[model samples]
Target chain A: MKRTFPLIIAAVAGYVMVVAYFMPALQQVREDAEEWFNILAAIAMILGGASILGMHLRKVSDRRAGWGFSVVTLLGFLVTLYVGLFKVGVPPMPEYPDRAWTGEYIAQGSALWWSFEYIIYPITATMFALLAFYVASAAFRAFRAKNLEAMLLLGTAFVILLGRSYAGTLLTGWYAEEYPNLTLPGLTDMIMGVFNTAGQRAVMIGIALGIAATSLKILLGIDRSYLGSRNG
Target chain B: MKTETIILNSFLGLGVIALALWMIAWGQEGKFLGAQYVEVRDTIEVYDSRELAWFRTPDPDDPEETIGYWVERAALPDSEPPELADPEAGDVVVEPADLDRFTPARTWEIQRGVSRDRADEDGVVLSLSRTIGLWFAAICTLFVFSFLYRDNPFYKFAEALVVGVSAAYSMVVAYWTMVIPNLIGKLLPDLVQAAFVPEHDQPFYAPHIGVLILSILLLWRLSPVGGWVARWPLAFIIGTTAGFRLIAHLESDFAIQIQATILPLVVRDDGGFNFWMSVRHLVIMLGVMAGLTYFFFSIEHKGFVGKTARVGIWVLMITFGAGFAYTVMGRITLLTNRIEYLFDDWLWLIS
Candidate 1:
């Protein structure tokens, strides 16, 4: 009963979404279902938060390796959660001066906003920036002219990289007026527009078919891995 | 530690201290360490009366149809009220006392101009909190960059903080933006309207009650008991996602792509033959077919099919190379921005 009930729910929900596209009347029902799903998803985040807290708490309690880092994680989580949920140091909207809770959780000058601007933005941006070095190093090691395919890849990358930079313009800009297509930037555009589009379209079509088949399997109850182990 | 390592660490520490001193000195000299802004002249409009009324207006799309929405109009004694298209529908006069319960009185208008008045403040000042935020951001940025050298304590600390802070931040944003406004506001409108959104007049939606129940069931996963019940909502989510993605992908990726690829092999511009455009169209058509042929696993690649598939692979390689270059360029731009932030915002070494 435990597994069957969920399977029935999945079938109904999936069919509703599929059928709603053709029937205009069922569009509102589909939208309502989507909204309900979003609400449930948001609530599910609390489950995730609880799991993280439990794991970290266990790590700290057991005095495991890198427990100090877990402590730092807990502190960061608790402080942010408290400041944001409580709307700490956040002023009410100018229109709703009497209502304290009327203020935006991430309002300017608020603790939550401060945490996000200072901690989250910087760390996220720097993390992405660090990838530049790794990618460059990886390219240097991997890019070789030993074979035809490798040589083609390397040549294409070189053209694209040079075309995007000012140095490519400095070198090819003179010939652009006389022979536009032969220039690096012009060649880059052509390759991207023709070759890239063709490859991407083919890949997208394959993915779409895969998705359709998988969805059908799930709807038909052929795929029940999402329901987890039968023993559970 | 090696002597070289000790010397490098010493230099880094000294550099940090020196930068900190410079920042303090710069701040003391009235130089801000964050974003600069410009002031502009704003035009303000003053209205005499606060009395307002709700007037029924004709739907713009269909003149015969009238919408239920009542457009708010300030009942200015001097100016003439907008004439309603529907003469039968009289104006619903809202009392002055009830104006607060409805939309607030629109008394003033502010017109923003594009040009800035740079003569004011010279655009070099930041708020106290913003200034502190700059320093904090700089410190975090350094900590994250430290990972490039080696996996150190500083990098681990920053990584842990990000995981914790980002998760909690998203949850808080989702709660305020989605759950409270959509669910609570629709289910218990009175309480939400009274405490949070005073202008929230949306009628109670019965389906929101079901959403609330489902949300509670989903949260049940947190508890030790009845964890299996959470599968119901999870299943619903998965089903809806699959259903939505299937239709979306088929419509956009499969059908639309096929439709777009069906272009005329021959091209003409201004009633004359265009060579380049014709070549481009032919290449696109042939390339797409070749790429598809490469993906086809039903027949073994041999002879002409093998040759076409080889061309397809070359096209794919070029595509991947371009994509890689684009990504690397983007990441390099981000790295440049971080360096700019350090030099321009923190150290004040550049303008």
Candidate 2:
């Protein structure tokens, strides 16, 4: 009953949504259905939060490697939650000064806001910055010119690397005024604008067709793997 | 044990960091390598936040009236360092007769499209706390970068804390923004009051009891016995997204793209044949057709089909290489930003 019930809901919702896209009368149904999904998604946050908390708690209980980091994670989570939920250090909105708890949760000097600015902002920036080092490492080790295909890729990469930056202009810009076609930037633009778009479009078309087929399979209950098994 | 590989790696890593620090110092002096950057010293005016409140202007012909959202209440931010003021800006005289023709959404689209950085903020003095914030931010940045040397506790702690804080923050945002405003606000406006939405703006429609039931069923996954109930909402979400996206993908990815491929290969100017442009067009057409043919699995890739497939592979390779190079350049910019922040904002070494 549990399994069949969901399958019926899926097939109905799928057909309705598709119909609504073209049928004006069913547009309101589409709007209401989307709202339901949004509400469901918001509620699903609890499930995500539970998973994070559970994992960290288990790590602490087991005294796992870097258990201390798990403690930090839990502490950070609780601190953010407490400060935000209680509106700690946040001032009441200018118009609603008399209200007890109604205020901007991220008011300038608020603890939550400050934590976000100093800690989260910096960490996110730095984590992404780490990519620079990784790219360099990959270039040194993994990027090898072993064959015709590899050589062509390496040559294109070199041209793009030079062309996008100021150095390319310095090298090619002087001569580019006469023979613009042969210039680094010109070649780079052609490669990206024409060659890249063709490949990208081809891939996108294939992906779109694959998605259509998969969605159909799921709609028909032929793809029961998502429900854990064929029986489920 | 200390080995040659370890020593070499240590030297290389530390050398790169040292070079970065030097670049920052040099950048402070407005010189990198031999190149000198000119800094402009000028005054910049900050606009009042009230300007975006309504589509108002100082002209008798365009007197402001309190008309619904046609007169916007949402205030734009005060132009900061990043959001510079437009040097070319002047008091504009608007005609309400002209504005009345546009829908409020059209007016909004036109207004929002105006670039923020069109404004120039050259001479505004930096705040003390802003400078201090940059210094602290740099330290955190360095801590993360230290993972390049070797993994340690600082990087792990920072990573975990960022994850925890972001997850918690996102949860709060979702509850207040989505659940409260859309779902709870409509269902129990009397109970939630104006917390979910402004009292005046609350929906007049009947509470969607069906959605509420579905939402509760969605959360039933937390209950071990009622886990199956969650699948109903999951299936609905999946199916709806699929059904909706199919048409969207067909319109955008398939039909439109296919339409785009049907183009004239020959290029003609006002009088003569444009040989170069025609060649470019021909190459583009061939590339697209070849690439698409490569992905066509019905036919065996032999003879002429194989050669076309080979060309397609080369085209794909060029695409991937360009993509990789673009990413490398992007990563360089991020690193450059931190370095610039260190020199310009934190250190105050640059004017």
Candidate 3:
């Protein structure tokens, strides 16, 4: 009964939302669904933060190695939290400055803002920047010209890499103007525009199809891995 | 159930209804009511064009006022334009035509009274065929799914081909859509303008050229010669990105999120208590505390702190479950959306 009821609700709501697409009268169903999604996502964001915090806290409590790092993370987290909560350093909102709590938390000079500009921005950017090094190392490993096909892939990779840069233009700039039609930049354009676009479109099509089939299976109760092993 | 839970939920439910109503009303009005929109400065071309390098304006249907620049190609001169500008100052000219070019022209729209243009009848007719073609393609989808039955050569071949084709396509998109037009189109023109137009003789293309060199260095490091060439470029990218992110994190995480937490209990205009919002914040704040506490490795999990930290575990689990469920549902919705597009819009499946 538990499983059946939930499935029924899913089917009904799912079908309704689907039907709502064409039926102007049923548009509200789509809107309601979208609203629900937003609320749910917002809630999930909170949940994500909670989970991240929880994981680190447990590490610290367990006196795990790198617990010190966790402490730093927690301290930063709390300090940022405090600054934001009180809207520290925020000037009074022009309309409500006389009111004690009326200032914006993220006002330019606010402590929250200052911390964000000084602390959080650099750390995350630094982390993301790490991807470049990773990508470079990964490319070295992956882009080996072991065979004909690999060579072709390597050649394409080289073209794309150079094509994105001024070096490409400098090397192939002659073709851009002299042959204009046959320039390296032009070659890059063709490779990217025609060949690359076609390839991406095909994959996207496959991914879309796979997603469709997978969803149908789930909806029909064919696939239940997501819902855990039990029916209920 | 406690009446408090009911009352709180009711208040939250009302807010949801109100927000939904507002969005619908906004959409009906053809207005972007509460969404953030950013506009870039100019158009992009296959090759470089200095005059047309900036990102265009916010989409016409944006709900919120854009928070960006008002600089013009004219203001900056064809020779020199600011790399980035505010999102608000200028009218953002949206280029829907660019998006339209990617798809086969929609003749079905013409048939359905959604559009009346007859200029691309051939494209539309082709689009119609493609719609029906999707159903045929669905057959291949089954073959792809055959892996579930047993791992076979056929599935493997199909999967590899899909990956190969997708990789090829993505490489192209990254270059054409994101790279060539963005880098060359913007820089080339500026370079030309700077060289010829004496007043605007700014060194525009040199850095890009330098970056290009570094990118090559990056690639060359793979070769046996000057194996160290890769590190210089890597260092630049890493350093810049790290610096940019460091500044951004403070604003986004510390400032914005914190600001978001401190809210007015009562919304003045509606005279309604923002109970759900407050509860949401409080729960989030608690969750953050608990989660962070749980991660504190310096302490032992033997006492009151240990038990309190466990609350973080429960919060994390429930959150993950909900997120997974929502993601699954969203994927389903996207699939359903695409299916409906095929059945109804592409092929006249029913009537």
Candidate 4:
């Protein structure tokens, strides 16, 4: 039931949504189904939260090691939750001046808002920015021009990287004024416009086709490995 | 305690579920009534009715006529059963507006269009051209895919062609979206208008150009003599972007998300009761912190901190597994969708 039920639901809903696109009558039905799915996903978040808390509470009680960290985590979690949910120091909503709890939890200038603005934003950005360092390292390792094909790939990459910026234009800016056709930037632009787009479209089409074939296998009751070992 | 917890939470969970179902029903009420429709109606006072007479005299029995006709909210009827409608009928009986809903992009029409506005052009010309292009690209793909098959000249040609095409397309989009709109729109008018008013003529080069200049400086690292020139712009971008993003990321990710976890056991007047949700958040926050502690690679996790960190790893692993499972399901769904399209929409090889 676990395996078959999910597959049947997926197949039915998937097909319905697709048909809904080409039919006006089914539009609302399709949108409603999508919204319901989202709401269910949201509710699942509560379950996830409970599971996390339960697991940690067990570990802290057992004192397996580094129990201090669990204490800190639990404390931090509770404090943040309390601050946010209680709307700590958040002024009442202007519409409900008499009500103490009418204000939005993340109201501007509120403590929760301050915490978000100051504490959370920087950490995520720093993590994202770390990708640059990773990219640099990866490029150094992966971008070896061992063959003619590799050489061509390398050349194209260089042209695109340069063309995207002022460097390509500066080197060939004189060409823009003198002979626009022959300019490095213009040539680079043409290569990207004509070549890269065509290639991307083709790959996308193949991937789409492959995805279709894969999906058909699943829907037709042929490939059901995703459900794990036991069908029931 | 466990039984009591389950009993107490069961009712709460049921309440939440009921609320969710009601919200969904309310949101999609229009669909249920079969009254949600998009229709475009315009009365054209044609100088000669013969010019567009075909639309006016469209066959009443034709399904296409009803396609665009909207069923008004007040007049909406119950959905006729599929069995009554004869689901076995292969033909699509959609209301007309659905067919004309999606308009292809201007550039796409231009690029893929047959012979740039030929009056006597065959309808299949664009399709044929696309087919030919696809075949050539597919062959090139096979060659590119041949890298897996053991690299050869055919693959090389495809790879090079792909690179060339990609570069060209990016330039086209950049020109339309960024260069012409941002640069020319700002510079040309002000320059022309400046002839009359010198103060108004001040050319405002967008800060984007400055950023672009800095980006160019990054390329200087490739050359020996002028590589030093790249550092100034690099430093500016790094410093400014870091300064700008530092606070924004922290607020949204850490503070607000963490704040969201707190549960209020008692609802102060007018604060809608969210006791369960707050507790849930607190738990999630604990999980996140534990997970982070697990990744503290620099510190040895031997004693108190170490064991707790280990628990954190388990949390992370479970989270990862869940995320992976979710993604797999999504991919499967996408795959299913495409197959349905092929079978039902484009190719009617299968029922």
* Ten-residue region with minimum lDDT total, candidate 1 chain B: B107-116
**What TM-score would candidate 4 get against the native?**
0.37
List model 2 lDDT by residue over B36-84, tens digit each: 1222232112122233223322233433321211122232333221212
Please compute DockQ, using alpha carbons, for every candidate against the native two-chain complex. 0.50, 0.37, 0.01, 0.01
- lDDT (0-100) at residue B335 of candidate 3? 47
Residue A154 lDDT, candidate 3, scale 0-100: 56
Off by over 4 Å in 4: A1-3, A58-76, A99-105, A181-184, A223-232, B1-351
Best candidate according to DockQ = 1
Q: How many residue pairs clash in each candidate?
A: 0, 4, 60, 48
As for model 1, its CA RMSD to the true structure in angstroms is: 7.1
Model 3 interface CAPRI class: incorrect
Quick one: best TM-score, which candidate?
Answer: 1
Q: Could you estimate the TM-score for every candidate?
A: 0.85, 0.76, 0.38, 0.37
lDDT, candidate 1, residue B329?
Answer: 93
Model 1, stretches more than 4 Å misplaced?
A: B24-126
lDDT of 4 by residue, B1-351 (tens): 599668756976896686466546744742211111111121211112111111111234663432112221222234421211223342433322232333312110112232222413443222332333323332333343334434455544443333323232233333333333344434464642322222233355453354345445544545556555544433333222222233334445444544544434344446676664455444454555565566566789889778767656544444433333334334444444434433332222344
True contacts kept of each: 0.70, 0.59, 0.00, 0.00
Give the range where candidate 2 chain A is weakest over 10 consecutive residues by summed lDDT.
A92-101
lDDT of predicted model 3:
0.44
- lDDT per model vs. reference: 0.79, 0.68, 0.44, 0.43
Give stretches of model 2 more than 4 Å off: A100-109, A229-232, B1-136, B190-193, B347-351
